[model samples]
Target: MDEKIVFKPIGYIKSPFEDVKNMPKSTRESMDVEAEMIINEEYLESMSSMEVGEEYMVLFHFHKSEGFKQRVPFMGNGPIKGLFSTHAPNRPNPIGVSTIRITEINGNVIKFNGVDMLNGTPVLDIKDIL
Candidate 1:
């Protein structure tokens, strides 16, 4: 089926990294960094089951990223590697997923660590790891 799939953002990320440059390579690399996921009011109920200290895989859009290349320099410095092999933001669908731990939850806001996304990044979904 040649149908297009659409998704609405459940929230937006508040991060320190306003630009892609100098950001950590992965969430694991930025465990010390703090961030916030401000869930839309309507989606607030969806996170009621979540608790502080839990880990969830957050899916988000690479809003600032553009198109992708089939081959790219690994880590922007290493030998050339296929796009899928690296965690580059550019992709056929500019979507990013990171497992982050909840540090605090207040009202519709979620404070977390392991931030690798840019400020104001659109969050698509959040899934429990276990």
Candidate 2:
């Protein structure tokens, strides 16, 4: 494996959360929050298999996160712990994964829930929640 890797966004999130502080602290807390995934036209064909009513694992880029601390407060206010032990956005690789439900799919747009991301966060990929 390479020491570094890169990726391009397959889509972007459209949500009411414009700021991190306003977004849900945990993925479960955002379970019912409505949001849209605006897929790129080039990837429309690939999205054909995405079924509505199914749960998916969404991987996204945490573009707004700053530097990480080796020890960060768990849950943002709990005891400080190793970064690996916490799901903090600030990390060496600012990638975030959330389990979301697929409520609707219209053309290249997917209307889903369980959003803990900001409005313009880049969606890296989607996988079946197995």
Candidate 3:
């Protein structure tokens, strides 16, 4: 039998954008956007050695975006294309990645900028952007 897939969220993201529709299409467009991630206790030690001014690739789960379609309408255009061709949230797995600069790190919270994710997103992991 095929093995079951599983994941444990290491943190949860906090962002200003509550509605996905209000968020800019990409993080590049939201230059001044900021977000905070509350790392779970189990993962706090993993971030104990991180430094400010460094960039990290944050992997997260899209907790709110539901359902997936093989084809979707794009940019208000007429032709429908495969969902893989675009950044639409509908996917077999709704994981997300965003690179952001680390600004501050408290006991269990890490603050960063260059945000595109909606509030309360589950953070799967973080890695150096290099």
The model with the greatest lDDT is 1
lDDT of 2 at 93: 92
User: Tens digit of lDDT per residue, candidate 3, span 77-117?
Assistant: 44788887766676778987888888889989998888888
TM-score (all chains, Cα) for each model: 0.95, 0.94, 0.86
- Which regions of candidate 2 fall more than 4 Å away from where they truly are? none
The lDDT values for all models are 0.93, 0.92, 0.83
What lDDT would candidate 1 get against the real structure? 0.93
lDDT of 2 by residue, 69-104 (tens): 899999889998999998899998999988889999
Residue-pair clashes per candidate, as listed?
0, 0, 0
Residue-level lDDT of model 1, residues 1-130, one tens digit each, is 7789999999999999988887888987999999999999998779889999999999999999988899988877899999999988999999999999999999999999999999999999999997
TM-score of 1: 0.95
Which stretches in model 3 have alpha-carbon errors above 4 Å?
73-81
Rank the candidate models, highest lDDT first. Answer: 1, 2, 3
**Alpha-carbon runs more than 4 Å astray in model 1:** none
